[model samples]
Target: MGELAVRIEGLTHRYPEQNADQRALDAVDIRVRAGIITGLAGPDGAGKTTLMRIMAGLLKPTMGEVEVVGLAPIRDANALHLKVGYMPQKFGLYEDLTVMENLVLYADLRGVVGRERTDQFERLLDFTDLHRFTGRLAGKLSGGMKQKLGLACTLVGKPELLLLDEPGVGVDPISRRDLWGMVQSLAEGGMAVVWATAYLDEAERCDSLCLMSDGHVIFSGEPAEQIERMRGRCVHVRDISGNRRHFLRRALGSAQVVDGVIQGDNVRLVLKEGVERLDRALLAKEPDATVEPVEPRLEDAFIDLVGGGPDGRSVLAETTPEVRIGEGVDRKAVISARELTRRFGDFTATDQVSFDVREGEIFGLLGPNGAGKSTTFRMMCGLLRPTSGDAHVMGIDLKRSAGRARQKLGYMAQKFSLYSNLSVEQNLKFFSGIYGLKGQAQDRKIAQMAESFDLGRYARVTAGELPLGFKQRLALACALMHEPPLLFLDEPTSGVDPVTRREFWMHINALVDKGVTVMVTTHFMDEAEYCDRIGLIYRGRMIAAGPPDELKKQAADADTPDPTFEEAFIELIHRDDEARRKTEAAA
Candidate 1:
């Protein structure tokens, strides 16, 4: 390895105000070398942030040895400040300031004055591809743009070591690839980087990784080596029970199966060790079903270590009534947005965008950050009225009877919109109460939700204190408490671990099987497989709309015979950009 950038031994940290038994980070040890990307990956509240803060000298540890670039973080705090750049989980970008102003302020704070400051500003602006949006306020910038700006601000003085915490959260795959390019280039230039993320793909790209769980470094090695641990236990499974979803649910419930995830028409299964046979026992009665052995991924390994996620069957699905299918069910359009247009001042957020979500199917609305997907979603949910055009829910006019129409729907916001001070049970009770449930029925619903989501243990705890995965479960439970026929999920799996995402989608799949209609928006491209049809929105326009296989087939050509969903998305966006360039040139 190259020269050591950070070295830790027997490090332990516990917040003074927190319970002494609850150690944020247990005895941990890890090393980071210069000129390589060292990924720190773990589930929510896995002590990644605590370790980063300790390395940054921002927080003093309760015990143990810590050294950054051969100097102690606390003892050489002043000197360490110039040698390291730390971007916390929530980057402290001044939301009101323009991109240029924020860059300048960060540079000034870093003491990069005079000609050096001006030169650095131009360099970072170009590096982040934010030169054109220099005048845009940080608050107004898209999620991807905000992440790039945060990286730029962190790179103000070119510190030897760069520490970033979840820098790619909420960013689309294309933008994430761009950010990876930037970080990889920096690493190649001999800058050591410690990136903390929940994304397994990101962890796989790292030169080496430190997989933490419960504040302990469970694994510290290359990604491939970690994946190799689960080599004999992985396989790709196909549906044999006629319905893929049903077969998958059966497979998950199988004793031999450990983890199962939907990956574009196929479910990848993580089988138990020594279970090489894929007979009728594992195939749910279809002995002839095709089962292909495949390479395991870092995600499978991560899920294994974190303890397998929730099983395939949903507890809530048992009691939740299905949306009754009538003779016209197949022809029914549960959610119809016709020429939906929403404008703010002189700027149009969604430009005559339209799509129809059929009954009992998952319709995905995908777009780059700030591409007006949220705007369209809010308008459809009756939270925001469109300037022109309109939406209909269950054939009811959203513009006119939004409240009455909304009664037939359930919504789970992207941010897990729960009262910070309310307990898990309390939040469930409150939402159910407002949705018209009362007395014993309300109480029964709350108990069911708590049990279904496996949140009974945290029922008394404040919602704010729950982990990211638990919070997601709680939010979903609250939404389904009403048992509405239609569900609206906004980035329901953003920033969650892979296992958690599967757990969530499993619940969703069960609901869909029960004839419920789902309209979801997510940044996770792999999730496109779960959608019956997807609408690709870019620059406030509906660019493409089709099933996942159709979209991928459309993007296929000479160089790539079968492009992945993400490649299809990028290719479509690239073509649109090229066309725009041509138009501008012609003008």
Candidate 2:
């Protein structure tokens, strides 16, 4: 329209292995206004990243044209680069360098110097709240702090156009809030930003959005309108048993009735038809069903847009039961932790944390940045030996029998741990061997994983060459190669699209049914619903633990009748702040 900050017409990009006709971005056309936050929302392999890269001048389209700030990214590469700040899913920070050193290096490389440098650095550090950590190495900082530093480095020169590719993935709620505040301020200052994210709620916060799917733009407009279009039809129902849940989900899918998702004992459904029809149908089919109308959310819009498979139960139909068969600590209690603690010098990362994980349960360890959730997880998985206390996996002590504990546990870190230089098949082989999964057992497991995750299509492709979604899936497959009774996932879905996340969790849920115990950490609060039990950490302490609804009740304030998890979380943090302030005043 009037001097668009970003304009794209018929843009297309295909990977080297992809057929020439198969485009990652198929004839996509869009325009982003100045001083606005435009979200590129979609599942993994949806081409949001590709589209952003093209607009940022980091990539060239196979067809069509893109212009940022009225200049072509390719032909006007230098000008576009100067006006744009591009941050990939990964920070690309030097782990050995201090936060200040990294910032200074980035600033100097961007030609910022002299008197302006000091002011710029101070302003950035203050905004990120990383001034105190300036002397700490980038690698040593917590996940949220490192992400803030990355954002600070990108904003060093205040480029007119900012392309953030999943920048807030794995970030804590407080850090996420802070980052969004910064984004709002930048947009108000007339800097157009294109933020690609898998978090639907985050996407809902944008001024506008472009929903990409299968390498094509499915919808583009304000998120409010998009959400409103699917209103008054969503409902939630709670249930148990994998077979029954699967049956219900399939039934819901077959009816073309509405969008549905399984959240441990609860399934959220959106009626494609009217609510009356959905009610009538459900009542007729399962008269005993405990169904109630719940407030709709962005996830409803996501399910409505993405949907199940061609037959309706495409994703849900592939459910596999959690596998928890093993001898030790009553197979039902797959993971047990009692007063776990880890200390690094003067810092106590985990402070007497205690929790028990049932076999076949999706247990989530959640907290804000610096809350000690990761440290606790590492100890449980035997990655880090706790300074004191205990952690047992399938009845084996993590500290005393780290090797045996590891054998029964599948672990996936924040980053993809597979070899980048090797092909997908090679990575699988390497991990299989490490787990001692030899001959027929390994081959059978690999084949099943390949088919389910669509790894066969990219078996020959180098792990490094795969897209972010594929990389995540491969990492997951590798982790599960051992078919362990327990799983520890640290923000496994941090940077993937909604569909990819859903798909990945679909597979995980299947494993849960087969008795696999999962303990995962995630920044996406909504994902907490999937866990059978949840532990909320704050300032190195376990503040809340139980079912999501129970914790929500516990975290709720006297003023709110029924607070959502996000609201409860905010309330808890505010209370913590108040208590800290009171302690300081007394001191």
Candidate 3:
């Protein structure tokens, strides 16, 4: 190693407020060196964040050696703070303050108030590309810009070692790439950077990785080595006809299949170890099925380490009846938006958006942060009224009667919008009541939801206190309580681990198989691949709409032959941005 930036041995930490002797980190050992980026990755409650805090001297480890820059973490914390830059999961940015104001405040807090401060501020402003938006309120910036601002604030003191906790949690792919680029540049400058993330793809970008689970370091080395172990085991299954979802369901259910994810028009399957090759028995029924080997990804290796998720089945669909369209509803266009427009003050949030979501299909409204997909989603879900145009759910005009349309819709907000103080059971009961469920029906639905999501053990636990996976389950259960024919999910799997993500999609695909329509908005480009069709929005306009494969075709250029979903998303967004710039120049 070049130089040890952080060193820990037999580190153990337990919160004074935690119930029992449950340690956040137990007998953990990790190291970070200068001039490289080290990734900290794991599922929720895996202690990645705890280790980061301890390294930054925010928490004193109960036992073991903890050193940063060759200095003790707790004994020399005052001096250590000057050499370290730590950004918690929730960066403390004053939303109402301007970008420059926030930067100035952070600089003052770091005692950088002089000519040196001015020079540092200018350098960081250019580094972060926030000069033009210096006067903009932090709250008014997009998710990406806010992250840049947060990074700029953290760099106020010019620290040598930087600790970032889940910096790309809700950021778009492009912004995430940009943020990573900045961090990479810092690493090149010999600053030790540690990035903790839930996204496996991000972990792959690091120079080295330390994968943790249950308060112990599972693997600490190059991510590629870990991924190499999963090679030759990854294969794609393609049906002669174009029913990838059905094939995915089957592949996931196979005895030999350990994990499967929908990729474009095929289902990528990871076979169990020692399986050598895909067995003909896997798709014996479909003689025309094609099986081709593909490269394994960090996610595949991650799933292998963490046990297999739900057994490729949705318990919620076990006892629920199949969705059936009632009278006066057009099955072809279960959800239709024509020239939809919504404005807030001087900004047009959704500008002349139009799309159609066919019955039994999972239609995604895909876009970057502040791209207006969520605004269009709100109009489509009847949560917000459009300034012009119209939206119809089940053929009912949203402009005329949104409340009536909502009776047939189940909506889940992007964040954990459910009551935090309420227990899981209480939230379920509240949502059931909100949907007008009553008496035996409400009781039966609650019981079914609890059992379906395997939330019986956590029924009495507060929604806010539950882990990330359990929170997703509770939110999904609440939205599904009424068993509406259409479900609207806003970033349903944000910040969740891969296993929980698989389970969530398994349930969604199962629901769609049963004829339920789904409309979703998500920042994850990979998750967008699972949608039947995508409405690609940018800057308050529907830039493109098609199946995931078709969208990739649209994104192909001279440089790329077959672009990944994230590449396609960025390409499409860049195209829109370039076209808009030309238009503005012409005007």
Model 1 weakest lDDT span, ten residues long:
323-332
Q: Which stretches of candidate 2 lie over 4 Å from their true place?
A: 1-3, 15-17, 238-253, 263-265, 273-276, 279-290, 309-328
> Per-residue lDDT for 4-27 in model 2, tens only?
788789887887868877878888
- Candidate 3, residue 366: how far the Cα is off, in Å: 0.8
Q: After superposing candidate 1, which stretches have Cα over 4 Å from the reference?
A: 17-21, 239-241, 284-288, 325-331, 583-587
Predicted structure with the largest TM-score when compared to the true one: 3
Per-residue lDDT value at 177 in model 1: 96
Per-candidate local distance difference test: 0.88, 0.79, 0.89
lDDT of 2 at 43: 82
Which candidate, 1 or 2, has the higher TM-score? 1
Q: Provide backbone clash counts, one per model.
A: 0, 13, 0
For candidate 1, lDDT tens digit of each residue in 1-587?
67999999999999875687888888999999999999999988789989999999999999999999989999999999888999886799999999999988988888999989889888898899999999999999988899999999999998999999989888998899999999999999999999999999999999999998878889999999979989988887764546678777888888888888766667778887678755566564666568888888898898888777667888778889867644543346878988999999999999999989998899999988988999999988989998989798887788999998888889999877799799998899889988999999998998998888789888889998888789988888888888998999999988887877887888899999998999999998888888989999998999999988889988898998888788999998898999999999999
54 Cα displacement, candidate 2 (Å) = 2.4
Q: Please tell me which predicted candidate would have the highest lDDT against the true structure.
A: 3
